[model samples]
Target: MYNNKFYVVQDGEFVNPNTNHLFSNGLDPKDFIVNQDGERYNFVGFIFNSEKILISFPKHSFSSTDLEKLPQNSVMLNKYIRILFNCIKRTVNNRNDKYVGIRNELNSDYPFIDFLEVYKYYKRYGLFTNEKEIKKFGYAGRISWKDTMNKSPKIINNHNLLFLPLIIKENIEQHVFISKCMAYVIDSTLERFSLFLEGEKTNLHTRDIDFSNTSLVITQLKKVKRTLFKNIHQHLVDSLISFFEQEKTKGGNYQLKIYSFHLIWESMIKEYLRTKFYGLNDRLEIEWSDSARNNHFEKKVAYPDMRGMNGFSIEPDYYLILNNKRYIFDAKYYQKLTKLDYKQVAYYFLLKHFETNRDVNGNIINELETYNALILPTEYEIYSEVHFELNPEYNVNESKFVIMAYYLNTLKVMEHYTNAN
Candidate 1:
């Protein structure tokens, strides 16, 4: 522990500590130990006061109560710490395949602890409460003779009589439903924590996570069963893979893991908007780009171009379609929007209006209305909405560009969206 502030150490270096209540002035780059790469990690939004350290990670701001729930050496402390360490390790090793762009944005010095906070936000706000289809294997269910033949004879013979084997099949669970996946993650985390509390050593080379847990309420999860007919909870499964999978570095010497906070923030906003506006109008539709290829555009030039390229592809964050109008929104975690940011979104607007002017139908569209906005996070109570009119030379009709800042507090977001006119 540094100055009586308890910190978990992995290989003599502080991994993830409770910096919310730490003494900010005491937090110096030189004070913390370096990683395996021989570099000191940078703690983003870390303020060292004389008495305590105020740490502001993504999705964790303006809320002291949430911080209080996670105190130093708490029962559930190891899970959070393990999460932080794994996330950083994953990003550093380039094991994060889902959010490649966001992973590229991560630096070696970025704090792992802050990444944990962003994951918490995803768990609370982004994940849905629906069931998904997963493959399951068990002897309690019945199946066709052909299906039973696919399973191992030993398992079938051991669980059932030879004559009745054809009537029953071994249940093979393979799909991931929302509730079951949640339970699996919770139970799996608790089991790992139990190992730490019981002084059991994991196969992991590092001894960063070793602690006791208070109790985990998993009674409801135990009742969930895998079903083949259920729909796949794609969002929940995508989010849970980071926590469930055991990803290792290229050298296979250590484990690497993390949930993408960039994706989490975008998902939270998308879900919030959907929930808030779903019942507003029957014709309203919200669409996500999902990938660059989905929203890509090709601009063909007749003459020679600067890069000698025929076209370029552009992808926006999200699209809100209300009747014949389209609103583009880009969620930014930065404190302020820059000129380049504005230009990028404006370019997206130009593409959607001019190049991709067709609707869901194949009918040609002559004119289109488009609006673009940049959503930024702030710590203060200032409610500022700024708009910039596009140049008239573009010849676009009813084009609007806006930069809106909102408080980083999740509660504020809910309140504003739920009560907005």
Candidate 2:
């Protein structure tokens, strides 16, 4: 099993239970497997039936020459990742108190590359390290007879209690810790990149980073007191540390998987919208569901089998409240939305309308106009918006809810929304 998930190599391609089902359904494997160019591929990474597969896209999967042939949507994945990284950075910068133990699993075939981009941005400013006072027994510095007596008593007797100076130097504890972190990231990236290029005969030249030197520095830096590093260096160190901590907790190869990407995409959209809408209007409030329980709303059960049971609960991705109206939004990172996806949002809209406050004279008062929307990442050259209105003529009530599709690229959709608002 790879990362505790079973997979088999079939026809030189990795097939997990999920992807296997895709193949069984007669869909092309290439449609689901995305490469760096955003092109669909039949295979990615090394084709091996190993239990511990490398967590990265293979370097040989795409070439610079194939850029023009790539699908238009191929760039959307990278754009989304970039936006997600920026959103997280913004969160770290502003409201740092809320950043404690914040973890998001990255789901992308080229997660390391995405992370490398973020790492490079921070590295450009240089790694954060602090000056630490370190004392060491050396032949030439301040003398310490106590330390000398503790060690080499015979030498002291022969030299009339003479002792070497205690060496003192400013140590970069934070830098060393950061170097150690970077070394791990670099080594893992190289290992996964190697897996992707495993049988190719071409002499591919991979970009090199001095991970060894960083690691050596880490070893030397360990001699100093660790607590000396202050929170001043947290901006750079915390960002990278949180990423590594996330990967380690997930217990998978270094690559970001698609399942995790769904969460990341949802978070990116919420954060992006939050930032964009900030200070624009006081009436607009963006709220997130911290957990399923917190977001849950009870609905009366009528089925015989479910008798005596509590009401069912529904949790939408987010609620965009403008004045008294609530706009329900569900973020789906899939290439296409399914019927169940539509029904789920519809249920939430209906539930909200039904459970809302009623007028004192036995009428529904202030029937908050509701709209349900499916937010999706689109690869279109131009943005598109589609609305499916529920006709009241066919239905029995004046209450209406329009389920709309918001096709947007996170990297460029802000301008469209801003102008419309």
On TM-score, the leading prediction is 2
- Summarize candidate 2's per-residue lDDT along 1-421 as a digit string, tens digits: 2132322221112334554452343333442565444433232222222333322221122233332233233354233323334443343333334343232222232344334543564446443345566656666555555655565334366558543444333344544555545445555554544422212121222234343454444343443324435543444444454344334323232332222334445555565454443211222222323221222221233222233246544456666555565556677765455454665445554556554568777677776666566777654532334446666787666445456666555435433222221
How many clashing residue pairs, candidate 1?
Answer: 23
Worst 10 residues of 2 by lDDT: 197-206
Q: How many angstroms is residue 193 displaced in model 2 relative to the true structure, after the best TM-score fit?
A: 9.2
Tens-digit lDDT track for model 1 on 1-421?
A: 1342333222222334554123433445543446555533233322323223233244433234444555464555444443333333333444436556445434223222233322343456443344334334445655555555565354446577553344453444342233444443444343432312122222222122221110112222222322223334333343444333322222211111122455545544554454443321222223323231222111222212234355554456666555565556666654335455664445544555444456688656665455555555543442435435455567555344443333344434433333333
Cα lDDT of candidate 1 equals: 0.39
TM-score of each: 0.38, 0.43
Quote the lDDT for 248 in model 1: 20
State each model's CA lDDT, in order.
0.39, 0.42
